[model samples]
Target: MTSFNSKKSLRRVSFISLSFLFISSLFIQGCKTGTKGIESGSNTTLEASINQGRNVFENSCAACHSFERDGIGPNLAGLTRHLSTEEIIDFISNPKKVIDSGNKRAVNLQKKYKSVMPSYSMLGKEKLASLVSFIHTYKDVPKPVDINEEGILEDPIPHQIEKSNFVVNLEFSFQIPASNEELPNTRITKLWGQPNTNEIYVCDINGKLYRVKNNKPEVYMDVQALMPNFKQRSGWATGFGSFAFHPDFENNGLLYTTHTEPIGTKNADYTLPEGLSGQLQWIVQEWKTDNPKGKTFKGSNRELFRIDMATQAHGMQNIDFNPTAQKGDKDYGKLYIGIGDGGAVQMKFPEVANGKHSPWGSILRIDPTGTNSANGMYGIPSDNPFVNITGEKVAKEVYANGFRNPHRFSWTNTGKMISANIGQHNIEAVYVIKPGANHGWPTREGTFGINTQESVRKIYKLTEEEMKDGVTYPTLEYDHDEGNAVCGGFVYTGSNIPSLTGMYIFGDILKGKLYYADESQMEAGRAIDFKEMRIALDGKETTLLEMTNNGHAKLRIGKDANGDIYLFSMNDGKVYQLVSEK
Candidate 1:
C-alpha cells in the first residue's frame, strides 16, 4: 500500500509540472506572435486601432488604470488570459450591463472594486476590436528597455550645442522678472531694450532686475540697496519697479529705476495731514554702474538722479532712452515715464486739487542732461504738450492725461508705441499713445458709459466731451471668460518655428495657452484670431508637459540668444526648446 501511494504522488507532481510548462509555452508563443505581427505590419489595422486606443487611454483611462499597480481602478494583469475578445467588447461597451447580468467576473469586479467603470460604447465596433486586439497583445508585456545600457539616446540632449546656418547670436542678455524674496510672485509688467548689446530688460511687479544669458539667468541689481528705508520698513515692497540703461551705457554707467519708498506720513498716495509731514516717498533714482564692462557686473554702484513719486500702486514709472535718437549726443538723452492716476478712489485735499491729480495720470518726457529741475534729474522736454500752456497749473512734463494704471506700453518693430491699460471691473484695454492723448479711466472703462451718479460721487465727474475723449477703446479685447489677467508678449522673430514667425504671442497668466495674433489681424482693427498652442512630448500632445502645481500653468514663452522659441515653466523651473520634427 505504501509503494502504491508513492507512485501516485510522483504522478501528481509530474502532471502539475507539465501544466506549468504548457502555460509558459503559450505565453512565449503569444509574445513571439505579437512581435512578428508588429514588425511585419500583418496586424496593421489592429495596430492602428491600438494606437488610437492608446491615445484615448492616455487622455481618459491612464488616470485610473495601470497594468502593474492598482490606482483608482484594479490592476489589469492577465486580463486577456481569462476574458474572451467578445466578452471584453461587451464589458467595455457597457460595464454596468455586464455586472447586472450577474457575470461572475463582472460581479466579482463590482464587489471588489466599489467604483463602476465608465462605458466606452461611443467607440464603435471596428475601434473597439482594435482596442481589444491591443489589450490581447499586452497579455505578456515585455519589460521596458534600458536606454542607457543599450547606448540609444534618442532625444536631443541640452549639453550638445549643434551648429545651424539660420542661427543668429543676439548680443544683449535678455531680462527676466525677479523678486526680493527668493520665490518671485509678481508677473512681468514691462520690457525694454538696451542699445548695442540688443539686450532686453523686463520689470516685475515687486521691482527687481534679472539678466538672462544664453537662456540661463542671473540677478543684475538688488532694489534693496536703492530703497534702504523702504527695505527697513516694509521689507516686502523694497525693490526697483523699473530700470533703463542709458543709450550710451558703454561710456556713461548711468541707469534709471522706479520704486516705492517707505511710508512716512503719507500712504502710496501723496495725501499729507496738517503739520504731520513725512519725507519718504516713491522716487525714480538715476544710478551709475561701477563696472562699465557689464560682463562680470560684480562691484557696480553709483547715483545719478531721483524723482519723488506721489503714490505706490498706480505709479507706472517706465523709463526708456529714445531708440530713434543717436547715442552720445547731449540732446539725445530723452526719457519717457508714465505715471498712474493718484491712489485709491476718494475726493481728498491732495487728490482733488484743481479737479484732478496734477502730475499723476500722465506721461512725462524729460531731458536728463539739463540742470533746471530737481538735483541730478533734468527738466521736461520742450515739445511736451503742457510745457507752455498758461493759466493751467499742469506740470511741464505732462505729455498725456486721464490714464489709470498703464501697466505696460511698447514700441512695435515699426516704432509705433502701443500701451496696455489695466481696467477696473468690466474691461482691460490696449491703446496707441498719442502725444497729447487723454485715456479716460476712473470716469469710464473702455468705450462704455461713465461710472457716474451717487455711487461714484467721490470720483471726478466727466463732461459729455471729456467722457467721450477720456475713454480709449482697445484695439483688441476679450471677456474675462478668456483670461483673468493679460500678460503682453513679443512678436516671434525665431527662425526655427516658421509658423510662429511674424505673429504677436501674448497669454493670460491664469490660462497657460499662448495666443497668436497676426500683424494683419491687428492692422485690420478686427478681433484677433487665436488658437490653443500645444507642446509636443515624444511626438504626442500631453497635458503632463503643460500642467504644473495645482494644475496652474505657469508658461513663460521667450526667445533664446539665437532667436529660437523656448518656454519656461515657473512652477517646475524647467526650460524647453521648441523643435519641429522632420
Candidate 2:
C-alpha cells in the first residue's frame, strides 16, 4: 500500500504534469509571442502574453510557490534580480538537472526547500518564454483577498463568479474500533442516511461503510469481503462506490449498494473479451437491516442484479432512491443506477459507444422491491425509456443514456434530478437530467462534438435543433481551465443557512473549489451562472484544497435528514458541515 505522504507527493507531481500539458496545449494554439519588453506599447503586448503565462502559473506553479513569499518553493518576486530570464527558464524546465549539476543557486535553493522542484519538461520554448516573462515583470504580488468579519471574501472578483456566503467546518473525525486508531486517509465517497434518521452513513473507497453516531464510526459493512475478486487499481476504480437507503426504510429496513464484484466461479452478467483476466463486474445488491431504526446494523444480503464492467474504471458509482417518488407512483420504490460508458471513450469499442442495447453507458431504473424479471433478480420498471422497445440490443433497464461518467446524481426534494458528468479530458459538466435524456457522451463532451474516430482537443458547437432534441446539453459546464472532476452537490432546502437555501451547490474534487447556482433557475430549465463558494478559516481566505490537506482525494458533498449540506474531505477522515457566517 502506498503511504499517505507518498500518495500526496505522487498527486502533486501528477497535477503539475497535467497542468503543464493543459497550459502547453493552450500555448501551442493561442499564445504566439511577439517582441517582448517592458516598454509602454511593448508592455501592452507583453502584458497580454504575461496574462496567458499567468494562467499557467496560477494553475500550475501557484499551488507550490507564490510571488509574494516563500512557500513550497522560493518566492518569485523580483526573481530576475537573482537569475536571468534564460537561466530561470532553464531551471523551470530542468530543475533536477540544474540542481544535480552542482549549480550554486540551484543547490542553495534545494537546501532552502526540502521538497524537490518538479520539472516542466512538457512546456516547450514559447510557453517557457511566456512563463519567464511573467516572472520577470513581477512586482509586489497581490495577496489573495482575505475574508471579512462576516466571513465573505474581502475583495470579491467582479462579474459572475462570487465567493460563497457559507464556510466549511469540520463536523467530526472517524475513529475505527477494530484498528484502535483513526482510519487511514481513505477517500470518503458518499455520506447518506435514511429519512428521519439522525445517524449518518459514510463509505470509503476500500469498501468499508461506517455508521456514525455521537461523532464516532462503527463498521456497518465490509463490502469488499463479499466479492472474492474485487479488483482495485491505484487512483482509478472506486471499491465500494455508493449506496442508498429505501425511502420507506423506517418500515422496510432495506437499502441498496453499487460495487465492483470480481467474476468468480459464479456466472457473470457479462465478461471482458477472452484476453482479459481478473476483471470485476458491477453489483447492485439489496441489503436489509434487522432493525432500521437501530444504531448498528446486522444485514441479510441478496443479489439484486449485476453487470460486467468492460472498463477498469467508471463502473457503477452512484445509486439513489428518488425522494420525491412516493408509494403508488410509477417511480416509487425504484432505484436509479448511474453507469459509465465502460471505456467507450475515443470509440475504443464501437459497440460500447453506439449500441443502444448495451446498458454500459446509461442510467438504469429498476424496482428492487419486486423479484419478477426475465433474468435480473430485480424488476425492470415498465416506464423505463428502453423497457418497451423491442428488436433492439438495448437493455430494458436503461432509464437514460449517453453520459460518459455520471459519477454522481441526486434528485431534489422537488423531483428534479441533477448530474455531474465527468468529462473525458477537457470538460466537467453539470446537467439537469430529464427522463429518457441523451447526454451525448461518446459523440460529445460538454457542448463539443467528439470525433468518434479520434480524440481532438477542439470542441464544436451543437446545432440548435440538436440542442432542442432528445439530446440535452449541459446546464452548466467548465473547461479544464476550471477543474477536472465535478463532485455533484445537492439543492439546499435547509433553514440553517438561509442564504444557501434553494441553491444547488457543487465542488471540484481536484481543485477543492465550491460553486453554487440558484435552484429556481435550475428548475426552469435554464443554464446556471455558477459562483464560487468563498471560504475563510479564522478570518483568512482559503481554498478547500488548503482545508482538506490533500488535493487529489475527492471533496464529496453530502446532506442530512434536515436538508443541510456537508462537505466530506476524502484526504482526511473529517466531515465538514456548511454553516452560516459567524
Candidate 3:
C-alpha cells in the first residue's frame, strides 16, 4: 500500500513516452512541412475531402473530440476560422513545442482541457490535414443574445460549500494499479460491497475488476482479456462500466457488468432513430462463476442487452440490487440500471431521450433471472412504472425518466431513493428519486430552465406555466462556480463513523471538493442544504486536489463491505479510506 501526498514535479512530464512515439511516428510518415495540401478556399476540394475526414473524425475523434460543444475536449467548430492551417498543423504536430514557445492559445487550451489534447502527430499529415479540412467547413455560429441573463444564477449555491463541524479524516490505502499512463490513470468508478459474500469489488473503466483484501487490491477479473471487442480507448466512460453481484452471491455465482464497444460490433437492443449517428454501444452482460467461493473470476458470460449511444459522455453507470431490501421484499434481486441521455440532447438529438418510450434517459428495473423481455434475455419487472402504460410504445423497464447524466443512485434504510446528476454547463444536482419521476434534463436543469436549442450554458428562472409542467426539480444542487462534475455518493450508514450516519457524502469530480447533505432531512418537492466536509491526511490537513498525482482530481466515491465511504482519485489511482479518527 502506498501513501499519497502532493506530487507535482513528476506529473508535469508531457504525456510521457506516448507523445514521443506520436511525434516519432509522424516524423517517419513524412509530409509537406508547411500545409501545402490544405485547400481551405477551394469548394471542389472541400467536397472531395469531406468523406475521408468525416469518416475519420466520426470513428477516431468522436469519442472526446467534438466540433460542436466542449466537454472533455475543446470545441473545434470554429478552430480553423481564426488560425492558419500552418499554425494548426504545427500545434497538432507538437502542442508542447508551441506551448513551450509561449503561444497563449496553446498554453490556455492545455490548462483548460487537461490531457484531452493528446498528440495528433500519430495521425500523420494526410489524416491530420483531412481532419482539419473537415473541421474547417463548419464555421462557428454567431452568439445568440442572452434570453435569461437576469434569471440565471451566476453562482447557484450563492455561498461556497461551507465547512462543517465534521472532519473526515482519511487513511491512505493501496493505489489501484495503473491500467495505462493516460491522465486518468484508473477509471475507478465504483467500489461495491456484497454483504452475503463479504467481498468488496472495485471497477475500473479500463476493464479490470479488483477485489480488495485487507489494504491491497487483487485482480479478480479482467474484462479486456476476456472480451475481444471490449475497449476503453474510444471514450472516457467506455470499458467496464459497473458491476452488480447477486444478493445471494455466496449461494449463487451471478455477477452483472456493463461495458462499451465500438459501434457495429454487434446489433444493439437500443439504437438511435433514422439518420442520427450513434457513436458507441454499451453492453450489459451477466457472468456465472464456476466456483462460487473462488478468489478469481472463472466464469461463463452472456449478454443481456446492448444500446447505442450518441456520445460517450453518459450512457450507463452503477447497476444495483437494493442493499436494504430483504429476501421477500419487492426490490430484492431486481437490478436497477442508471442510464443517461447518452449525450442525445447535446448531440442535437433531443427527442431520442425525451420521454418514457426511449431507454436513453431512464432508470431501468429488471429481473435478470427471468427471460420475459422483448429480447428474451432478461425480464422486465411486471410492476414497473411503464409496464402497463397504454396507447404508447414505452420502455417498460423504465422506473424513472428525464435525466441527462444519471451517474449514481442508491436507496436508504428509510426507503428514500437519492441520485446525483452530472450537469451540462450550469448545475450539478442531487434528487430524491421516485418511480415514474421526471427529474428534468435538457430542459430544466436544477430548477432553472435550459434552452436546449440555444446554448445549454444559458439558464432562465422557470416561467409560471413551465413550473407546473410536472418536472421534479433537484433536491440539492450547486453551480459550476465551485466545481465541474458531481460524483454521487452514498448515505453513510456504516458503524465506523457514527457521526457520518445519514450524511450523504459526495464530491465534485473535477475540483475534488467534498460536500454532504443531511440525507435524513432530504425530501421530494423540497430542496435541502449541503455543506463542505474538511479532510485530513494522517492528522495533517489536506485537500484531495493536492493529494493527486496531477492537479485534476477525477474523484469517485465508493463504499466498503462495512458501508464505510472510500475515496477514489482517478488522477493518482489511489484509494483513501474515510475514518472518524486518523
Model 1: per-residue Cα lDDT over 373-442, one tens digit each: 5343476667777667777445566665565556555454554566556443234455656676666655
- For model 2 the local lDDT of residue 561 reads 75
Which has the higher lDDT value, candidate number 2 or candidate number 3?
3
What is each predicted model's overall lDDT from 0 to 1? 0.46, 0.63, 0.72
Mark the 10 consecutive residues where model 3 has the least summed lDDT. 11-20
Q: Give the lDDT of residue 65 in candidate 2.
A: 41
TM-score of each: 0.55, 0.70, 0.82
Tens-digit per-residue lDDT, 1-582, candidate 2: 000011111111111222222121111212234223433357678788688666555433322344443322334454444344455566666666756776554444333232243455555667777776765565443322211223211112123356655664333434333321222256578887545767878887677888887767888777878656555433444467888888888888898887775555356654443333324577777889998867666778888776665445567889998888988888888999988865534323534644345666788888887765655478888777766776744667777778878888887877889988877655678888877777787777777665665432334566777666556777877764566678898998877766778889898877777888886677323566788877666566677777765424357888877787878765566676766554
Clashing pairs in 3: none
Comparing 1 with 2 on TM-score, the higher-scoring candidate is: 2
> Which candidate number has the best lDDT?
3
Among all candidates shown, the one with the greatest TM-score: 3
